[model samples]
Target: MKIVVAGGTGFLGRHISRALLDAGHDVTVLGRSPDKVSAIPQLRGATATKGDVTDPGTLSGRLEGAEAVVQAVQFPNHPIELPRKNLTYDRYDRQGTINLLSEAERSGVGRFVYISGAGADAASEKTWYRAKGLAERALIGSGIDHAIVRPSWAYGPEDRALNRFVQIARFSPVLPQPGAAPQRIQPVYVGDVARSVARVFERAAWNDVYEVGSREVMTMNEVVHTLLDVMGKKRAVLPIPSGLLKMATAPLKALPTPPMTPQGIEFATQDGLVDITKMVQVLGVEPLSLREGLTRYIER
Candidate 1:
């Protein structure tokens, strides 16, 4: 099989590309910065092509020989959109997918896979979920044999999400969770996500979508404590009142590359629990529990 993984240089995309390559497929990593594969030893055997899905013009010839196309791209500074640079979820997640589907049609690609997030709803008021939901719809309507895999709070050593807390626990005795909300999340290991995406190509029939996540459901505080316990750290989990945290980070949005934004706060507080039964049944992937995943994450 010949496949193109868009955003192959990214955190999840890199792993997906490697998994496809390991599956004995000819993998090409297409991204805005495809040359990043030079630094990624795991992507050694895969081809790297520079392309941006946000612009249809850039993707015309990119998927020419690809039998399968995977849209795994996300905007820079994710969760903290740089609207000034047109780096919002609507741009990269929604329109970008529409562009890729157009090219896939032209290129006569057989399959399309979208890496969507949990809680995706086209009718939602939230831009992130709405964008992904809209993208899922576009692929379904494209007449392409498509599969959508929605992962819940994917985390790894290189991931930007969980590592933030791990880094904080590295120095401090107390880990301050950004919000007091009992935000439910099922953190999936990145490796499991990559393998599940690769297994989509292995199946005899394609399911419309697979929502992948750990079987273990946990809250924000519980997640942090789990990581601390895995790291042999006795850090206290401190939850900040949402109102105060929002007030504090609201002003920082004015700064370029603001460390935290109101949207980021909302992103941190949102619930991402999903049923993993479909993923297990279809993809044959039972995502690792948060503690099991953290053990692997920290050991490496």
Candidate 2:
């Protein structure tokens, strides 16, 4: 099978490309930066094409002659100063997804896999979730054979998700956790996610959405503490009022991708557990536990 993974230079995308290659499928990664794609050894054997999904014209030729298409793109370094209301979630998450779907359909791709986050809501007030929801809807409506895989709190070496917290813990003597720090999350290993995508292809899963996550449902504090324990550092965790933390990070909104946007804070405080039954049933592969995954990169 010839597969094209959009945004394949990204943290998750890179791993997914490798998994596809390992499965003996011809893989091609289409992304905004072809240079970054060249850096990955797995992708070196696979094709790398430079294109932007937001601008369909640039990606027209890139999607041609592909059996399957996977959209793994995200707008990471966009302006954080832009309020959620004014953010380009529609432009990037929603429209960009639609653009990819249209191209895939035009190219007669057999399967379209959309990588979305858990808890995405089409009717939500939150821009991020709403945009993802919109993208999900667009894929469902595109009449292209599609599957949506929603992952919860993915982490690995190149992960930007929990690395933000790790960076804070490295610098500060105290780590500020939101609320009671008991908000639970099922952190899925990136390798598991990559393998799941490959398995989905191998099994020919079509028109189904599955959530990928690990076995352990750990609290926010436990996650931080585990990282600290792995790093062999003792950092006192202080539970700051959500309001206070939001206020403190508000000034830093002028930068691209603020560490603590209100929406991000909301996402962080909530339980991010997912129903892994479907993923297990369809993919037929066991996902790695959080502790097992953290050990790979967690330095002593």
Candidate 3:
């Protein structure tokens, strides 16, 4: 099988590309910068192509012979450094996804797997969720066979979220959290996410949305403490109110790639745990526990 993975150089995309290659499928990564695409240790046999999904014309001949298309591209965390107008989520998460779906349809691609985040609501007032929700609706309505995999909180080597906690815990005596610090999340390992996506392609899980997560449902405070313990650090947990977190993240609106957006902060304060029974039973995937997942990434 020939597979084309958009955003194949990203955190989870790298794992997915490698898993596909290891499964004996021909893999091609589609990214904007060809020079940025290198032969990853996990994807030694795969190829890379230079193309932007935001512009449908660039992807004309690139996806010609692919049997499956995995849309994994997303906008960077925030619009702080970039102009707010150009950095809007609609451009990439929504319009870019639509453009890719159109091109995939044009090329007669069969299986379409989308890596959408959990808690995306089309009717939500939040811009990011709305964008993802709109794109999801379009994909399902496009008449193409699609599988939407929504992971709770993805963490591993190169992970953006949990790794931050590990890094901060390494030197800090106390970890500051927001909103009661009880907001639960089931952080799934990147390799497990990759395995589940590959399994979906292998079994042709079409016209369904599968939610994936780790084996443990932990509070935000618990996650931080666990990472601290894993790294042999002694750190106390402090829970701040949600209002303060929003105010703290307000200044980051000017950053090009902010570690925390006001929207993301709000989302983080909410419960992000999901039911992964389908992925576990149908896909036959068992994700790592939080402690196990973080230990492999942050061996401190």
Candidate 4:
């Protein structure tokens, strides 16, 4: 099978691209900067193409002869940097996906795999979730064989979420948390996410939505403490009220490169747990535990 992966230069996208290549399929990575594709070691075996999902014109004829298309493009800043560089979830996630789907349908692509988040819902107030929900709806209604994989919080060596926590723990004696509420999350390993995505190409996975996550569910405080423990550091966790934390970080939003944002704080405090039975059974993958996955990077 010939597969085209949008945003294949990104952390998760590269992993999925590599997995498809390992399965003996031809893979093409589509991104804004095609030249930088060679810089990523994981994308070594796959070819790269210059295409941007935001601009539908750039994606013309990119899907030709491709049997499947994986919608993996996302705004790198995400909830942390809203409207950064004039990029938002609406423009990137929702509209970008619609553009890709339009091209895929025109090019006779049979399978469409979308990487959605755990809390995706059209009616959700959260910006990211709403955008993803709208994209998933578009893919389902596109008259294409589609599989939507809604992954919980994913983490790895190159991950921004856990790696940021580890970086902060190395320098600070105090770790600030959003609230006392046990914001639970099942952190899935990036490798498992890649394998699940690869499995979507199989005939059994078509027209289905799978929620991927590990077996362990940890609270927000537990996630931070675990990172501190893995890094061989001890930090006092201060759970401040969500509103106060947002207000405190409000001024940083004005900086050219703000370290944090209110939307990011809200995402951190929300519960992101998911049921992984479908991911395990259908994808035939057993995800690594939180400790096992974290230790792989932090201990290095």
Considering every candidate listed, which one attains the maximal lDDT?
1
lDDT of each: 0.88, 0.82, 0.82, 0.86
Tens digits of per-residue lDDT for model 2, 1-300: 888999888888888999999999898888887877677765768888888888889978777889999889887653232545345777777988999888888888878998988887899887777888999999998888888999988999888767877788778998877767477788999999998898888888888888999878888788888888877789998877666767777776666556656655666677777889988987886888877888888766
Weakest ten-residue segment in model 3 by summed lDDT: 76-85
Give per-residue lDDT, candidate 1, residue 245: 83
Give the Cα RMSD of candidate 2.
2.4
So what's the TM-score on candidate 2?
A: 0.91
Write one digit per residue (lDDT tens) for candidate 3, span 1-300: 999999998888989999998888999999987655675566577788988987888988888988888988866554222435466667887898899988888889987888887777789787767888888999899988898888888888877777667666767787877677478889888989999999997887778888899978888888877878788888887888888888988887677567776666777677777889989988889888988777776776
How close is each model in CA RMSD to the real structure? 1.2, 2.4, 2.2, 1.8
Q: What are the runs in model 3 whose C-alpha is more than 4 Å off? A: 78-85, 252-261
| Candidate with the larger TM-score of 1 and 3 | 1
Q: TM-score for every candidate vs. truth? A: 0.97, 0.91, 0.92, 0.94
Off by over 4 Å in 1: none
- CA error at residue 89 for candidate 2, angstroms: 2.5
What does the lDDT read for residue 19 in candidate 2? 93
